[model samples]
Target: MTRVSDPSAPRIAIVGATGAVGNTLIDLIEKRGFRYRDIHLVASARSAGTELNVDGESHPVRAVDEFDFSTVDLAFFSAGTEASRQWVPRATAAGAVVIDNTIAYRMDPDTPLVVPQVNAHELDRRPRSGVIANPNCSTIPLVRLLKGVEQRWGVRQAVVSTYQAASGLGHPGIDELKDASRAALDHPDETYPAKEFTPSLAFNVIPKIDRFLDSGFTLEEQKMLQESRKILGLPHLDVTTTCVRVPVVNGHSEAVWIETHGVVDRTELVEVLAGLPEVTVHDRESRHAFPTPATVDDPDRVHVGRVRVNPNNPRAFWLWLVADNLTIGAALNAIQIAEELVERRTL
Candidate 1:
């Protein structure tokens, strides 16, 4: 891959441009002020012909089947695993770097699963196959916090239980929550209407995110463990995860417990986390100070709070973190990867 010396020379394409992540990417691109020679938005045939107004210009959404990837320098895909499975090769073979927000290529040895704050150095070497996988939404914030702790004190074990938002499933998930909430008000004794995978999400939490394996862990839970190991370069890192779907519409929350190799004092740990870019430390004695799904505002940073060291184990610590799943977890991260490539002249 040859580096593009001029930052404004690279033409960009956002595949799946009508979906949740794609829309968020468009919003953040405007907010972050990235200059590109040209921008293309491609989606499925059903979403084609839709006009998206960005940077004061209306760009018509084109069908991916008709759009050519050869002229594009970078592509961000979030359609789904199946679409990515079929199109990523074409994008790479045409010389465009693909930052995929799907599970399709994440575990592929040739593809680097990345969370920028945790392992931006992985971007130094462009993928030989011209593809990089964005870590899972829940995994993104979890790993972001762990990176600081792991660097200051080696990580031995990590336990995370996620309170994932409906948005993780896409716009349909959001719609389901809204419809269910309205239905629940009159039919409190009956199950609310559900067309999505969830049966009832308005007033309840489902202990499942993705399909369960024989080992009983959902795919979402396993992604956190496996992706964390790959990004942190910890092959045997002990990680236990439980992923659940909650009624919230945007942000994702996590209750985390970590055991490090050395004892890191509470004050020092707070300072270290605060020093990391895009991470906010808000631990306080009052419960009101702790982070919740509603507490997440900026789409770029991870909010952390409720820090405490285990009384019996000096090496163990617990905390809560929240982040905008659609923004920082998906779109912002994919954009950051593309930005990193441009900054390093690897585009």
Candidate 2:
């Protein structure tokens, strides 16, 4: 990851620089020119002292405990939840504002779960704490698109099902799917059960995502239901979700049914989505120009397609949206929030 443009910040730190999303965070921070004078990189203790390049120069990873946050202004925490939980407060307490990508603080009433294109104002509103939580990758694009709709015309209910990519589970999950697929291909009968997922996820889709609750909703499904309403600031909005893990290595796709307060045109709806910033509408049914993981593997734009009204219900419309699970979903969102903080003088 290369740092772009101005090298003017007093101090900045990127915790967990070696992981998939963490590495991507550095790539974007550098790509967008969120420059810093002292750019500190941290990882687990074992990964300390390993060198990473910024602006083509080597920078060694530091132990988190050894990192002095007294002079740091902005810190991007892309580590796992437990690491974020343990160190984020320490950094923030030292006066560095934290933009965390983990789910650690997302549901906290005081901590705003931010998506720049959606609830950027939530980050703009000050007088709260120092840390900000980035929304889940699966939730980011889906919620961002929905937020646009909700602001203009109210939406009453939604039924969403995700064709989530293996990347959502991180590196281990991706490897698990790959290994399972290889075994299935070789022996056909001696297939491995999913190492990260509950069922086999190689060339197969698992209907269950995350741990199931007694309430019968898997955690992933529940996150979609809950995070959508929270990010849109319509807590009472009815939303149902079914999250499935697919064999794709990157990008998560969704099939969504939106029930609005009033009837709306399918064509106009596509137009609205097309016009929205950071979103690309691919609504072509004749040639099947719908959003798929292969088509939008690494794009920043959220691809939307298959715009159609439900034949049985005119008020309800079905649509498809896809986004890169690693970048746009988590790292890019976090960096965008950091960019917002700089623009709004929050950091």
Candidate 3:
């Protein structure tokens, strides 16, 4: 955390400052005491003129089109894929390093798709494309644990099913879930029109997230596979996923089944996971010890539980994980990238 008053601190801009992840970014900057010479908040035209507070000072939100990218040293783009696609190049061209939170630049050959816990070394130098891409929410937690497993016992393959929250869609998605749930409870016969999630997500789980690919997997599922490969530097990694949207408002959970090349010892497995940077493993010592999205105490750390190796197949094991989609998945990762850049003098 650099001193805000220091003349050398970066001048930063937060695009999509009105959205869920954007708001979380502001909160984290305050909580972590992230310093900057100046901070600008930018959003769409509709959200312009609105005021948001950072470090107890009020700042007016500026429309992205009107804000000059050259004014900032670093810009974080979380608006959307289209927004990032439209504005990221402008920001980078203006000599501002961009940390993008969209899918636009993630798979680009020159852009680094980063998860700080797994690969902060990637930020040792300025990116060739002048932008760093954050991995998907579910992919972030999965890859963090996978890094440890792949090092301890070579990972043969991984199968994951994500129980993603409505917050994955941002603020509107949460509103729709609450409205749809209320409609269902008050009037059981009527259907609540679902805009964020198709066929309603109230008291229901939809197995499809994002759109369907020709290969029968949704785009969200595809992102997990592709992003995991890029972040871990495993091009041909066998990671298959089924992404589902649950009714919860925040926090994404995953049930992972990983088969390694060697036999796994449960005691050592727990120790390996527990030793990771910010992972908490709840073993099966108590009858009710696993972490749920609602009960997980820390939003910043990844929570893991249910450590059991298949007795029949000693090479495979099962684990459950929960992480805040907005924080660990999006804003927090973006800020951490900025922190790494500042520390390494890369930005």
In model 2, the Cα lDDT at residue 155 comes to: 91
lDDT of 3 at 219: 90
- Candidate 3 ranges with C-alpha deviation above 4 Å: 1-3, 284-287
Name the runs in model 1 displaced over 4 angstroms. Answer: 1-8, 284-288
- Can you write out model 3's per-residue Cα lDDT over 225-329, one digit (the tens) per residue? 999998989898999999999999999999999999999999899989999998988763552589998999999999999888999999999999999999999
lDDT (tens digit, per residue) of candidate 1 on 1-347: 12234556688899988889999988878887776778899999999999997787889999888889998989999999999999889999998999999999898898899887778888998898789999899889888888888888989999999999999988988988988998899788988658774668988899998898999998988989999899988899988999988889889999999999998799898889888888888773343477777755666889989898998999999998999999878999998888888888788
* Alpha carbon deviation, residue 127, candidate 1 (Å): 0.7
Best candidate according to lDDT: 3
TM-score of each: 0.95, 0.93, 0.98
Predicted candidate 3: what Cα RMSD to the true structure? 1.2
Model 2 Cα displacement at 138 (Å)? 1.2
Please list the Cα RMSD from the true structure of every candidate, rounded to 1 decimal place. 2.8, 2.2, 1.2
- lDDT, each prediction: 0.87, 0.81, 0.93
Candidate 1 structure, TM-score to reference: 0.95
Q: Rank the models by lDDT, top first.
A: 3, 1, 2
